[model samples]
Target: MNQPLPQRNEPFRPGETALLLVDMQRIWLEPGADPSHPERGPDHYFYRHTAAETIPNQERLLKAARANGVEVLHTIIQSLTEDGRDRSLDHKLTPIHIPPSQPEGLPVTSLAPAGDEIMLPKTSSGVFNSTNIDYVLKNLGIRYLIVVGIMTDQCVDMAVRDAADRGYLVTCVSDACASATQERHDTALNAFGGYCWVADTDTVIARIEALGKSA
Candidate 1:
């Protein structure tokens, strides 16, 4: 059997880390988008929110990470053309639609980082696959990645796995990510825990606060 990777014992070092927020678009949250799937609608209401509810937690993580001087990187699954010609086979299979320009200057989803934050566009699930994300992270000397976003089982999982494979310390804020169902979200978290630090929003907040104090 392969030896297990060691757990991260030390708290996050803010300056060396970046927070990556993945797709959290309104199209995935709207009621009529999937009428047959009630979970994706606004009615599931767990913890005063549904499975589509991840905006507040994402916003909190973004604020905390920014306050501590951690780099913020936002990723959206958009194609290079209006017809989505650059989309990957996986994207083509999924119903998520990303026009070439929807994420324009406004915040359609909690996915957008602030104006100063780095914005990366990807055609595949992992941000590093078709984008210059790796180059930008390398140039910034970022070695730790904090991931928070929508669809825990898809883009977020892919990004976390890729980051770990690339030798970055990865942390996934469970409370800040969501999926269409509890089963999907939980399953992904369980699998991801083997590769990355699976943490709650409170834990991440405390870690960021500690890092801020140390700085």
Candidate 2:
């Protein structure tokens, strides 16, 4: 018999798994994007490194997901109204928050969802709070989530903790997510490691490949 996955094996069912890509909007991933311009300035090193490291890793993870027939879900952060009426409390407190881009935010080109893939639109850092993602996952009988995307210290971090609390087994692809700074990225993973297994793209890909359908 195949061994249970390294940790928290019972609930991490492959057939019940979904690969969640969080906040990969162009506003956060693209270098010259209007929302990211301030953070992508000539002197901004964090974004420079993020675009370099995170995007590629996310692309690799995406490829593996598609090839393996894994369910791919996307969560993009955006305010639902121009007047910011729907914005979350933490969003309002942010000093220079980016408003949601029109007709949904622009996702990075490489990460754009195919027409049929599920896209979870959200106004809060926690994907489950502002979106029907949890409901969808539950309906699909999903019990495990392989999470990846931008701003690891913020959206990705919150989503990970939220999913854990909601009783979903989660594996965070560390390299496939980014943050405002390396330190923040590391800090988030450190704190959340207790709630979820932290793995890189290679490890995640291998696990996905090895997963079996629950009968």
Please list the Cα RMSD from the true structure of every candidate, rounded to 1 decimal place: 4.0, 3.8
TM-score of decoy 2 = 0.85
Question: Best-fitting candidate, measured by TM-score?
Answer: 2
The TM-scores, one per candidate, come to 0.84, 0.85
The list of candidate 2 runs beyond 4 A from truth reads 1-6, 9-12, 34-39, 95-104, 212-215
lDDT of 2 by residue, 41-100 (tens): 744765677667788887887887777667889988777776677778877777334455
Q: What is candidate 2's CA lDDT for residue 7? A: 57
Model 2 weakest lDDT span, ten residues long: 95-104
Candidate 1, residue 3: the lDDT equals 100
Write one digit per residue (lDDT tens) for candidate 1, span 22-56: 86554455554533355543455432353334777
lDDT of 2: 0.78
